[model samples]
Target: MTDFLDPVLTFIADNPSLAGLICFLAAMGEALFLIGLFVPTTVVLVGAGTLVGLGKLELMPLLIWTTLGATAGDAVSYWIGWKFKDTIKNIWPLYKYRSMIESGEEFFKRHGGKSVFIGRFVPGVKSVVPGIAGMVGMNFTRFSVVNVTSAVAWSIAHIAPGVIAGSALHAISQISVRLALVLGALLFIVFLSVMLGRWLILIILPLFPNAHAAIARWFSRRPDRISQWIGHNFDPAHPRSTGMLASTIILLVSMPAFFWLIGEVAPNEPMVRADLAILNLFDSLRTPLGDKIMVFMTTLGDGVVVTAVAVAVALYLFAKKAWRRGIGFVIAIAGTAIFVPLLKLMLHRSRPMELYTGADAYSFPSGHATLNAVLFGICAVLIAHERSRWAKAAIFSVTVTYVIAIGFSRIYLGAHWMSDVLAGLLFGTAIVSAFAFVFGPIHNEKIGRLTVAGIVCAVLAGFGGWHVHRSFDAALVTYAPQVHKEILQAADWRQTTWRSLPAQRIGLNGDAEEPLVIQYAGSLSDFAGLVEKDGWVRPPKWSLSTAGGFVEGETPPDSLPILPRSQNGRQPALVLIRNDPKTAKGGRWVLRLWPSRFEIMEGGTLEPLYVGSVVHEDILRPMGEFSGPKTDRDLPDADNNPARLVPGAVVRQRPGGTPVVLARRPEQPGLASQTGN
Candidate 1:
């Protein structure tokens, strides 16, 4: 593929809401700052980021939204610290993770707000850093300075890779069918990993809630063992270094390396979701700018994008004197960027398009999703330092919106399968969360606060966007007599809209005086069949009459896709309301009048049977008598222009009954249910 962004940019233009959401979610994955880059939301976030290249949506709007969200998320975390301070460790998840909190506290005391900056990367400290900063009562100016600076730099840092990838997707989309399968296999692997993660959470997480904690406990049990192991297996300083260099090395080196390995073995699924039908739909929209946008997005995606972002973030942190934090951001960014591509080349999996056409390659770890995920998650952790409630809420909301927006952009852009984005998000979140745990606050208070926060977040869902598709035309006829299933089994559902009789009659003996009016007002497509062959019409004396017409008026003509005109008798059709007369077979007629009507039994409903066809079919030959008004005074100009009548004109049949009138059926419910006619 020449570029990754080709599809991503197009998707952003078409699905702005989705773009906003992915960015928001990625930010929420963590608010700890650059350290948050460890979260897996890169796929989701970068996908949304790619939208910027499309040039349709302005970056300012999204930037404001995401920055605020990150700010808000971290702000709350900080408030929780200010409110309960050192006591928050008693909460459910936190209580179980007391050591992490203690680790954050001790780290904070020596490093001050710098720990908050550095804590953005340390898994345990990422979440607790803000809370710890708040507990220690750091100066508001210093905290905000660090918070906003980190938040802005972090967002760009995380989203850069995603935008790069989107730009490249264009060239990938141009390849032959052979490569498509390979891409598809890669997407499949990404999907598999996501499902595995989900299953792990659903099945294994609850069962082993303390896996990380247990490991910590295990290590605690044998301090000497941990030290010896650290010396043997990793940097000797990890267990004893003042910077926790030994633990850091083990975390940075071991687990991430394993994840990279997992990514290598994964397969791909190409074309992922951009189908020919969808491409055709857009092509028909006739906008040349469409392809242009895709091309721009895909080309921007490259490894250098990640590297540059990391370097920038490191520089910023160092400038701010948050040396440790600068180090963490550098480590996390460098690690993810290096590992993802290595795994891709190692696995050599094709994109979904490679396997099948238009698929992506080496997608086990979605880059876009991971980028935003890690950045946002880290930001959330850091935002916890903000003390203002409104401020925190606003930023938190915005961060989540961006994360979710970017996630959607990936799918809409057709750059990643649904699973790749989700798995990437989850994986990113896990990593950032690990950092948050190690460097976050130690809450040892009651569980009430955590419960309240959960409830509050859920309440926000109610106010979010709510939408659904609406389609009328209630029941579609899949089988009609006009194009009977005999020849084309698939030609059953015919769409029609006619205003005439539904049935017709032909008798040798009966006088034309009455015309044996069986029904009128709908259309004639079903006349010779249901009434003729189906059992609705009797054999001896009476028969039916019918014809056809058109429909009109709507909010907008193009609002609804036009139902195609009939060719070879297969077209869109409709049923007009009409009437029946002269004791027809429907529900055993009572002492009838000139026109007819019946109550037929369907399920438990004794519905009034006016003029309607059993099936939809094209109305042709507009020759037969028209279905009209019931009263003589309302008689339409039937003699002169009976084929097409005006609205509200009276239509009378010969003698007394109007041209269209009902012959009421007998009242017996049992007879209504049994009428074979």
Candidate 2:
């Protein structure tokens, strides 16, 4: 595909002015007599749409070129028919396929100008219908009028879907995975609706006669007000107009109300708390296996994956002659792409801080959650309509489960709050429901070629999964510097080094335990002052129940709780504490800092005492267990509590370290003076 498209794409990319001509020629070929039957322009038009999205071609020019080309193609066929008249059927291919020409003539006679309009949407019939009109000596003015209108609609129907698909792909790739999921879901919903709508139209068409008779018989039996009301309101003859009016009313009223509600409550503290609680609960339950599963499920909701599905579905619908549904699918997706970003900009809500990699966008109305509800929900609706009872029920169940899982994945990954997901579900569902009302209640036949869909989806997911992994990995690597800066700023401290306490001298009682000691080059007052900076507030066990002190910017706090007075005081001691609910990691620290001493507990702050008051010999130890021996007096067990130090490279060891001592009284005045100096 690339080999075939590269030259064309390059020509257009280099000489953008010729894009119109190329599009015109391509669409003309797709619509021209005889040539239209063989040339598959759907792929070409879709490719051009993608190029337009990539900014290689201008959108308006492309649309115009395609429309004009299609109109011209039909005009040429009409002229051929006019000139040849009744003898045109004697031409080789025409004579060979005289039945098709005869049928077109009959169809034209039956539907009149509307056949010309509807024929533009069907593949083989489109080229033949125009010629049949001319052969029948249809009014030239009327033929031109129908020809131009259908051609324009036809052009948009083909080209716009491609453009929309390409544009959606581009937009999602530029943002985070979470956002991509949201957009993907909306696209999925639109595609499903279009597919379903096509099938529904078919099903409804055949049933219309039966329905009318049944209704008449039932009405005779009733002869009542209810029957009259039903007939008056739901009369199928004008249901499309009724549907449009009702859909319009619902969309106008409900969409604004939904947005308004989101706007009103998004900034509320309670909402924030709810988000935190749900996220924390999920995060606590997360395991490596679950994470892997969530990652794959989330990948399915990616923009690229979803876009591929939409394009594939659109092509299938077009192939099946489901024009209205195909066009609606494209419109629905395009609208979703436009709306999501606008909402995010308006709300500007921040993301939770517990994410593996920092997010760069606002959080309210999570894109992933919205996508899950809209896209997967639509898939369920579509599948439920045509499949057998058990299959439909099973497919519907899985789709719902998948949607829930995707939403949960976002929260578990700390990409969004629960409220954000909730709002997303609401927004996405409303959009889908509104669109369904306008162009749907899709009752499409069961679409075959599941193998094709599966292959496309698998390829998309593989690529999207790789893209997401690369993006996330890169984000995580660059996150540390920002984290360090944020942490320092929050604690109200600049970078400083300290002389390490000598491990042997600080009452280790001959114990061989060596704990990682952080070397800070500052006074006790300076450390306390940094802690008092409000952003590093003490955890609830030591203070208020409501968590606070830090806010999410671009990184999460590494603070944990530890008791200063006792081994089990419940107060977070000697650690940098971020008490904010948004940034909390739901764990305690193993290390602690004090005025003249540092402590390393056995297992986090809650564990038994491991090593305490090890005034380092001006070198911060690099490693220690959370729980172990209290004193250095015990013999080192080879397999058990081995002592290690923080790598000297990290702390930047001095060439010849300064001799620092920790003693209440000195044996000699000279030694004491030297230590002080």
Candidate 3:
């Protein structure tokens, strides 16, 4: 991926004029009527912003070109609408999107002059609003004023996120390239998911009214009692029909899936193996930062947090004197609370890790998962019951994302298996749906949806914050990775026992990575002292001051920080780097050491074993202004240099002819040196 991106970035840097032109065309294409629908202008514009942040492209020129292109595109669209106002509705492609045109017209009428500005940021209607305004003979002066200002705001809104992201990635790469990449991928995925969800909802929702009408027609044509009964209960004209039908469908689907999951988990089927595989995968990917994030997410779904929110919402509903609605809300929460524990008792499944004892150890249906799902699921239904399609889509999207995050946190933290979380979500959805279907639509007109939503959010922020702050430390300790230790006699380790250790670093996907080129039998401090004597220096730790070095672009190669790499989810304990000025662009040789599980027992004292790798990195200045390090694949010949510098250091060869460096602190005086291939 870096190989592919490097050349493109280089070309952009070499020809700034051409890059600006491309940005202009992309912005224009994305704003043009109908053509804008196919052009991925937002993504292209964001990419441009990223290049700016990377110092490959100047920001002001690109922003100016993009703004002009957008303004021109809107003007052209308005001209077309005005010229063909009488026949526009019957035009070939325009006729096909009659519904969108009509929707845009209605939006324009409702918001008046403001729609011209507001619609530029809205997804479905952004491309058509300008045309609609012209067709309706809106004041051209007003349109121009709104158009120019909105185009500027829209461009900034879309591009600023990318700029921030690029700047963040650049800083993080200095600490760990792998971490930067992981975080980048996660952010991109989240952005894509949100856009795709919104688009899907917008496209599919318009078809629902037609579908309901068709289904109603079909039922009318039929004479069967079952068809008549379903038609009457699900009639589109009825106030509560849509809610009842949707809830019933969800209940019917979720109940069976929940039972099937139970069956699969009980029999220890293929899903069980998959659960373990996923657990191991997450275990490998665990980092200190990731652990902290997952812990915070999991805490949001804790029993105390969810219960507090549920109780707050219930009280608010009762205060508004909405008796039936309050009762249904209570039933959904109470049912999930009861069902989760009952299932756990019946199945008695164990968590991936023994983080808890007694009743808390059982993990068939994750209480955290079930409680949060129930709380948010019902909240979405209640809030969206009387809202427009757009409001409903936004509400459900947020609710689903939150619930999924909580469930994933449980799995990532090793508190529950994947199947356990899945079962819990399915069961929780079933409970919420069943209650919605039985209770009909909630009516609390006196309490606005926004008011209810605001109260819930406020309580969650205030109460949940306190709970997490109190419990975060204990949660971290409980979820920390388990370590195992082994001891071997110093003589045995020197002879043959060393072969039992891992030969290569393991990646997140369980793939073999860099080979372990050196093994030292000494304390970390001793190893550091030996290497420091040879002119090796520890890289400066990451901080605001150090981060500024990347921007200065003149920091010596040796002063620049080295990116840390992980082996089996563990970061290096000791790192040292030495400048290599012989390379054309200047280079550096980095040495990193990770402590092993094994210890060498030398008489009364125990010396730890360390395994490490060495590599030479060449400086890369793609744009000549911002520089980064690029690692060379072939191992440098300096592999044995560190051990050679140590006093009384011994070297031996492994079976594959790779060299292993061995050393001991002079203070420990018990080892017999014996070496063989």
Best-performing candidate as measured by TM-score = 3
Which candidate number has the best lDDT? 3
| lDDT tens readout by residue for model 2, 425-444 | 66776766666564544445
Better of 1 and 3 by TM-score: 3
Report the C-alpha lDDT of model 1 over 107-176, residue by residue, as the tens digit. Answer: 8888877776666645446667787777878887788788776667666765665455434433443443
Candidate 3 colliding pairs, count: 0
In candidate 1, which residue ranges exceed 4 Å CA deviation? 1-18, 25-29, 32-41, 53-57, 171-677
- So what's the TM-score on candidate 3? 0.63
Show where candidate 3 strays beyond 4 Å: 1-58, 61-76, 79-97, 109-115, 134-149, 165-193, 207-209, 220-229, 232-290, 342-349, 418-440, 444-451, 484-677
The models' CA-based lDDT, in order, is 0.41, 0.52, 0.75
Task: Tell me model 1's lDDT, rounded to 2 decimals.
Answer: 0.41
For candidate 1, give the lDDT of residue 448.
Answer: 33
Expressed as tens digits, the lDDT of each residue in 1-677 for candidate 3 is: 23224445676777788777887888778777655766668778887887787777887888888888788888877877787875877887566567777878889899998997898888778878888878888889988989899889887887787788788777766665445544555555555656665554444444466577678668866899988867776778877776676687779988899999888875536577567655654665566777787888898778989989999889988998878888888987887788777878888888878866666789998898889988988887777777876787788778877887788788878889888998888988888788777665545445567877887788789999999899999999988975546888876776688788777766433456667777776777777887786778888655444545566656667767666576554667788888886887888888888767788787677878887887778777766775687787425453445755655555667787766766666544544444446
Candidate 2: lDDT over CA atoms? 0.52
Query: What is the descending TM-score order?
Result: 3, 2, 1
- For candidate 2, the C-alpha RMSD (Å) to the true structure equals 24.6
lDDT of 3 at 423: 88
* Clashes found in each candidate (C-alpha, N, C closer than 3 A): 212, 35, 0
